[model samples]
Target: MFVECCGCKYYHDMPSNIYEAMANPEAVIRPRGNVGFTGALSMTVKCPWCSHEMSTKCCAGYAAMVYVKERLH
Candidate 1:
């Protein structure tokens, strides 16, 4: 599974255990950040194609596609 860059919409691979991390109640990726290009957390991610940074807390899966799509507007 992977997340898309908010800048170029390029799909970047997520950490193999990201879903697992999300399940941890103690995990705190924060609601926003800009550090997912190389070392991605459960929150932020950067664009590999354009280098644009954006938050990924709410758009981490297909279930959130509606919310993520709404954000594009």
Candidate 2:
């Protein structure tokens, strides 16, 4: 599938087993990162077309969780 974020586009190959997961209408965790003193950060996005899952970061913490929940559902 293809995703557009912040004016950038990302493409992901749907794993045979996870293809259905992409249609769950919920956001799924994608990637994680650290923000040193802030602890961790994360980014999350909803597939605008399918309402699937996508995320990134590690230190963003609750912000990430909130983003996931808000964007997915």
- Stretches of candidate 2 off by over 4 Å are 1-8, 25-73
TM-score of 2: 0.24
Which pairs of residues collide in candidate 1?
none
* Tens digit per residue, CA lDDT, model 1, 7-35: 56666555544544533524544433454
Where does model 1 exceed 4 Å of error?
A: 16-44, 57-60, 63-73
Deviation in Å, model 1, residue 13 alpha carbon: 1.4
RMSD of each: 12.1, 16.0
Q: For model 2, how does the per-residue alpha-carbon lDDT over 1-73 read when each residue is reduced to its tens digit?
A: 3223322343444443233333342534333344345432233345454554444321111211113445544
Q: Candidate 1 at 70: error in angstroms?
A: 34
